[model samples]
Target: MTDAQLGLLVATPIIIVFAVALRRMGAVRTTGAVVAVAASVAIAAVLFFTQ
Candidate 1:
């Protein structure tokens, strides 16, 4: 994988965890958090392969 793709692989989970923590802290709504996480994964998957 390219550097950017590797970076994304590393970053995506960190970001997802961070966002989940935020949601648990009541800083984000459940619906929004779920959608964001799903979209993040989908986007990362698409970019990781297509690029």
Candidate 2:
């Protein structure tokens, strides 16, 4: 598989895990939650596209 595909495969579950853990850790605030997820996705995007 391509790097992008691999990134998606890896990042999806990672983001999900992070979201769930962060939520449980009391980071359930709207802004913080979004920012946390967004940052992870952004990092994933960068890795996905950078190759």
Candidate 3:
């Protein structure tokens, strides 16, 4: 895979963990955290394939 793809793959779990913890900490609303994570993953995926 390309560097961007690898970067994204690695970032996925980190983002998920951050999302969960942030939600628990009340730093991010439940729905918002999930949505944010989803959007981040999508952006990463797009960047991966495009690069």
Candidate 4:
């Protein structure tokens, strides 16, 4: 995979973890979690198409 794809793949899990942690810590609400997951999926899709 290209560097961008690789980066996105790695970052996907980190973003998920961060979102979960934020929710657990009461820093992020449900909307924030949804946004975070959506953004990560979008990024992955972009990387997939571009690669």
Candidate 5:
């Protein structure tokens, strides 16, 4: 796999785990999770397209 794909594969799970941890710790709400996922996806998309 390409670097972008590898990055997405790795970062997506980390981001999701962070979001879940934040929610459980009351550091973030549902909206925060949504935003985090959206931002991660957007970044992944940029990496994918720019590569």
Candidate 6:
């Protein structure tokens, strides 16, 4: 797959895992999930587009 697609694939699962971990660690469930996903997507976007 292309870099962008690969970046997204890698990022999404990572984000989900982090979100779940954050929830389990007693963070606010919704906030944790949002932050994890947003952070992952932002990083992925940078990596995907910059290369």
Q: Which candidate has the highest lDDT of all?
A: 1
TM-score of 3: 0.77
What would the TM-scores of all predictions be?
0.89, 0.56, 0.77, 0.80, 0.72, 0.55
Tell me the tens digit of each residue's lDDT in model 6 across 1-51: 687778677767877787888888887677768877788878777777776
How does each model score on lDDT? 0.91, 0.76, 0.87, 0.88, 0.85, 0.77
For candidate 5, write residues 1-51 as lDDT tens digits.
Answer: 787788887988899889989988999898988899888878888887777
Q: Identify the leading candidate in terms of TM-score.
A: 1
CA RMSD of all predictions = 0.9, 2.8, 1.3, 1.2, 1.6, 3.2
Tens-place lDDT digits, model 1, residues 1-51? 799899889989987998899899999999988988999999999999998
Ranking by lDDT: 1, 4, 3, 5, 6, 2
Clashing pairs counted in every model: 0, 0, 0, 0, 0, 0
Query: For model 6, which pairs clash?
Result: none
Single out the weakest 10-residue window by summed lDDT for candidate 4: 1-10
Candidate 1 has what TM-score? 0.89
lDDT of 3 by residue, 6-48 (tens): 8788988899899999999999898999898889888887887
Cα lDDT, model 6, residue 49: 74
Better of 1 and 2 by TM-score: 1
Which of the two, 1 or 4, has more TM-score? 1
**lDDT preference between candidates 1 and 5, better one:** 1
Candidate order by TM-score, decreasing, is 1, 4, 3, 5, 2, 6
Candidate 1 local distance difference test against the native: 0.91
Q: Write the per-residue lDDT of candidate 2 for residues 1-51, one digit (tens) a residue.
A: 696768686876788687778888986866777777788777777777777
